[model samples]
Target: MFNVYITKAGKYLPNEAVSNDEMEGILGMINDTASKARRIVLRNNGITSRYYAIKDGIITHNNAQLTHLAIEQLYDSRFTKNDVELLSCGTSSPDNLFPSHAAMVHGLMDNRSLELNSSSGVCCAGMNALKYGFLSVKSGNTSNAVCTGSERSSTWMLADKFNNEVINLKNLEEQPIIAFKKDFLRWMLSDGAGALLLENEPAGDISLKIEWMESFSYAHELEACMYAGGDKMDDGNIKPWQDYQAEEWLKQSVFAVKQDVKLLEKYVLKLGAKSTKIALDKHGVSDSDIDYLLPHVSSNFFATRLYDALLEEGIDLPNDKWFMNLSTVGNVGSASIYLMVEEIMASRKLKKGQKLLLIVPESGRFTYSIAYLTVC
Candidate 1:
């Protein structure tokens, strides 16, 4: 098998950074009233600023465009877009349902025809895309691959999307306030895209050698916790958007992202830590061997909790070794990990032979993905 290395990392955060106080202005207030949960959620998530792809109710860049922009930055003296043999993309929010996200991204690229793959999930989708690229190169099926993760959540979080629900509720003389489940995500998510170019050989003076990657799902024992484009049934099943009538779509804000906060509190860290221990043991990598911990923490609220959970599992990595950028970038779902890795690589803090452990936890039915890399 060939050894695959991440030769370059690129990211594109759309437009300017929007501060916490300016969020409601861009997203607009629901029902002309500020959200009661926005401040509380922001305080807990610890996000100071974030980006948006919207301006005056018009989308500046769709998910495909954001991804294309990120991929363009990956080109340099040694590698270019046309040199890619495979392209794998992942995202929680795609521009359309018919054309796969990868296909749309490829359509925007000024490159030759290449193999494409699109992974669909919440946060773990990005890692899954990277895994596909790594394996394709390892098996000698391709010499190089470009993997990306991006999100354009602003399109769904706009106040106009929720206006219909408010109108429907007011018509019935009910409270005009949207549910906390729906309002909670508005202040928590932002727009961005990140990409990685993987090649069979290490490039430049620094490259990350992918040692191993593992994924685990507890869906067999858990129910969905975070979702969109569907409604959750009482029996723990998600009813797809197509299952409901057209009128109910806007009235229910069916496409707006929602989460069961209680479920996330119960399982996200516990399941993630357990999976980390399993992957470490399976690969014979001890916690002490990890020089850096790049965790895709959705919020700062879970940072201390996750550190303690890993301790409970006999993995005692210290806080100094942890790395995250959620506070400045906001939660970009699948793109979070890629952005973190890109920032760290640009920082030039990594030393040769150092080990990097990446953990991505998704509360969507309790899923986790772990990857191990060595600096070369």
Candidate 2:
């Protein structure tokens, strides 16, 4: 069996930072009620801060641009563009609805010696891409692979429509100005990018090796969360809307998580590793076994739900460790898990020989992917 190791990982956020109070100021001018609602919404979601791209930025800093930057940063000076045997990009936004983002990244990197693949199955794209890349390496078809996810929620956000319809539904006549301010923009959304470089280690530095990857899709729960193109108004501006049934979305997400945990248990058994044995395995050795978890940042509520479930299964975790970054990052779609990995590594908290568990829960036709990694 080929052992696929993560060589490097990196993430980039836009230069500007948006805070909650600023968002309220922007909303206050448009509709005081909407501003109040926005505060409640953000508070409920547990998102205090996020990043956005500047208007004059070279790259749009959307999903594709973020992914590109991440890959470039991770592989800096270590490998030439041609050393990459495959490139995979996962995102909800397509470059134009025709050409895939993978092709765009490949062209940007001047990578001419690899097959390119793209994934767009909503939030699960990143995990799916990683699994696909791992399979390619395990099958001996590729030696080096790059998987990336970039998201710019700001560009896709229709501030006027979002604020008007969702927040100030009762008194639209009171606030008429389309006030677009930093505060409102901050609460509206943020952008970020993350990438991982994987390779088949013949005998060199191996950061983390993938032990197993599993995915389960629950198709019966489609439409639990959705996005629809909006009708053009007389003013000629296009709008978009979210179709979310919060209660049902939560149900499916929980189900998916349950299934994912079961599969993870089975994989651990296959590897001769049990939940109880994780702690006693090793100390500081390069391959000493430790449980390092990286789960998808779905929502504050869902994160807690998963935590409870893990606790029920006797999976002990340090307080505030598993879902630490979700409150700040929000739901980053496919980029959440990878970005969590980046955050954990940056903190210098993970020791060698630790086991990292990555769980990704995607909405709408809910799908869950679980990956096991051993820190090297």
Best by lDDT: 1
TM-score of each: 0.99, 0.72
lDDT of 1 by residue, 1-376 (tens): 9999998999999988989988998999999999999999999999998999987666799999999999999998678777989999999899888689999999999789999999999999999999999999999999999999999998788899999999999999999999998999998889999999999999987899999999999999999999998989999899999999999999999988999999999999999999999999999999889999999988899999999999999999998999888988999999999999999999989999999999999887888999999999
| Tens-digit lDDT track of model 2 for 1-376 | 6899887788887665557665444323333334444665576567777666544424345556677778877765667666788887887655556678888777677657688889886667887788888999988989878887766665444334344342443354443433222233234345777888888883234377887777766554232333323322354332332343444332222111111223332232222122222322322212123366676654464455555555554555554445357667655667777788778766777667778867666543456677777777
Clashes in model 1: which pairs?
none
> What is the TM-score (0 to 1) of candidate 1?
0.99
* Weakest lDDT window of 10 consecutive positions for candidate 2: 251-260
In candidate 2, residue 160 scores what lDDT?
41
